[model samples]
Target chain A: MKIRGYDKENEEIKLAMTPMIDIVFQLLVFFIMTYKVTTMEGDYNIRMPSAAAEPTLTEETLEDFLEVRLQADPETRFLQTIEVNYGADRQVWNRSAFPVRPAPGEDLTAAQLQQNRDSRKVFASLNQFVINIVGSGSSDPGSGSEIEAEIDADPALRYEDTVYSIEAISGYKDDQKRIVKLIEKIKFRDTTNQSP
Target chain B: MRFRRKRNEILEGDLTPMIDMTFQLIAFFMLVINFSEVELSEEINLPMSELARPPEEAPPFKITLNLKEDGSIKYYDQLIAGIDVIKPILVREIRQANSDGVATSDVVVIIRADMDARTGDVQRLMNKCKAEQLENFSLRVIERLR
Candidate 1:
């Protein structure tokens, strides 16, 4: 195609489309190499203990709070066990009912340990309890009266284990294919001595 | 006939096409680059959870805190040594939020803690958040790939 209107005179101007297209191709390649689609991070939400003393809850809602205490093994400094206390009832959680591998020198039959590393009876029991008490329809483990969880952990506890305990208590996938947060709110039991 | 060489002639090419292409690339990169990434750090190994899901909408206001396994807390690559260092920053943020017509309570704090960090460190950071009176918070977790 002939190009015009370059100067005041009707000089025929021609664009070097080939070289232009080549440079454009290079630019496109550069951009494609650099483009990155970023997914949203931080999927889990938790409440931090308010600095000021929060107003006291009414007598009715106070009972909905579940206190979960995480204690680390004094020797190993790893999370030893978790204790879940709700009003009058209390439950202690140990390792998975089935062990994948015994610690260093413990003697156990190979058949005694399960292979799945994530097998934790505590998580199962917690899920069942949430289902029974707070889950929807007396069966749905996610729908129930609003319940909040308060976690108290030994200062020596590994944050990893503390997070696992929080996950077991407040995390749940509902039947509706929605993430139904069982523990809508969570707070630390004590913050006075822990401030760094 | 004697042949005469053309004098004072210049060779030029239209630059509009190349400029257009460059601008297009600039637009593409601007759209794809993650702006919020500056808030996070490589030091944190965020925990994974089966129930974790992406937030339905972008948070209205957010401040990301990174806690390393060694118990160091950082905000945007700046280490926060103590409450004294953090309080001023958070107060400034609260004031900024108030200027934007957003309540101090509406701002969300995202804590990205290393999986092996001590709970005490995270609690300390949370205490600071509480002191700032920031109610909303999210703990960064990778969604379990099932």
Candidate 2:
């Protein structure tokens, strides 16, 4: 007859707890390294303008809209010009043409000349550009009579600059103290050829 | 005289608490981990915007395209060669989005680009998306005051 202690030892099953614990610990480490806590990071959504069919907008009516071209200065590598095209006539607004503070008795420079010459000229602020594109007149405000603006920006332009342009164009209040959306509709023109 | 201890004395401790604590930790990690981070590239630094607001509703279908400062594109954690390579991939994705009877217009294309990325690269990508008739596009930005 086998002894009780020997029989118990033979029948008992042993689990290697150490290896299992090691594996669990490994998994914990993996999760810790790869884990990311999600936050409200992606808050901004921009609608991409397309040539697709829209029930309300027809091709013939869109031909008369305004077009703004943002071109980067090869030298400064910044948005140097704003070319506004209204029915084939192009007016270039130079960034350098915007005024800077002159000395108390300093002679007027080119920028100040442009700023003073044309009441509609875009001054140092982007708001001026917005105003020029969307008429500053408050009369008959909140009416949906304004034409859509098409923005064609160079591919070399920085993302922030483009956002600023978009913000300026989209967020404008009309003269009636009501939100008169000047550039209510915006279409991004494809300047993909400029990309390297 | 010195007393002798018993040779076969069983020494036991409770393992239920240790296992419980470890399992709890595993569950915690799993719950807090975000799988979307895998698709986001670290090279791109998102821009800031004052108007940016958290999406009101979760999009039924969404795909994130990461564009680095150099204009290199990353989709689903893979680097695509150029617009040509990404074209077919987006077409396939649009088809996949429509799998559950959702329209192509309903699919949201999230553009996550570096602040220094060129507008041209983004436009090119947008053109491709437009070609596929995918209209909804969202540009991701960090929320901050102007």
Candidate 3:
């Protein structure tokens, strides 16, 4: 309880962390267990389309969400492509079974002819298949991150047909829908990137 | 007798205790310090959106949604086609978190979006949240706290 060299017998002494080693050991274990090794890879540039909508949910209601993909040509206003990004290496994309608008009187498969008769309907059916393909193993319907979307057709593709096409693929009136709550998210890839 | 007493006094105040304290302090800092965080790609220029909010602070169970300049989505740091598939994963992750009793509602979703991201794409992401009823998300921004 005193310094060895000091001649003052009244000198006050203290135990400097005589038991602090235990604290160090405990911290070592804590940090080790708290260590997280996330393997998130890739650096995809996702330019989020902004919105002025009011916020919902809070810091207390963590839930699921969907990542929607729209591949459209602004110049043509066509609903070129659609899909949803679930995770890395997984997707539910729309496949157009239309007969590529082939020249008149060309032989086509029954499935192809059926697809052309109802392009929008066919597109919708394909998308439905894509949606059902997911959560199949799950017993719950809400067990999915189902999204609703609105197609803001490009000026060229903004035709009633295009909108019809989009509506066919995604059932909803662009306002009332659940899950992905998708709508026409315009900002497409570089328009200037187009080959003139 | 005085000489013997002086010899006993010399044994007091050994440095072993102070050394132990120093080691403990070092261990504490090393444990709390997040050196792995430095590995995040600096090329990621996360844009700050007015629609963005702060992330949650808890046991660190969070989802990261990386945005591209062209309004595409990058999840788990990889390129995903769209939200159709992303939904199931989010549901599964949240359901799992909820089952573990680890406060799934406070799940900190870090939206790492690009500066040139489109307003529409941003809306789509938020819409995805509405579908699942999940909240407590934050838009990840690059800070100069270093």
Q: Which structure is stronger by lDDT: 1 or 2?
A: 1
**Can you write out model 3's per-residue Cα lDDT over B1-146, one digit (the tens) per residue?**
67987777647557677666667666666766676464244445563222112323243466666656555566654676764457876787788778777675456555565544543454456557545655544445432121
The backbone clash count of each candidate, in order, is 2, 3, 45
Q: Per TM-score, what order, best first?
A: 1, 2, 3
Error of 2 at A161 (Å): 1.4
Give the poorly placed runs of model 1, Cα more than 4 Å off.
A1-14, A17-40, A48-53, A57-59, A74-77, A96-119, A136-144, A174-180, A193-196, B1-31, B81-84
Pairs in clash, predicted candidate 1: A135-A143, A136-A143
Q: Rate the local accuracy (lDDT) of all candidates.
A: 0.70, 0.68, 0.46
Off by over 4 Å in 2: A1-24, A37-39, A48-68, A81-124, A127-149, A170-185, A190-196, B1-27
Q: Model 2 over residues B1-146: C-alpha lDDT tens digits?
A: 23345545565676768878888888899888877577777767787654456688989988789988877788876898776568878888888888877888888888998877788888888877887888787888776542
Q: lDDT by residue for model 1 over B12-102, one digit each (tens)?
A: 6667776786778867775776655777786777876777677889777888778888776788868876534577878888888888888
A1-196: candidate 2 lDDT, tens digit per residue: 8776885776758676878888888888888887765445654454554544544545766554767788875643456677777665567767653223378899877767766445223322454555564564334435433656778887687776666566556554445534444455666864434434
Which scores higher on TM-score, 1 or 2? 1
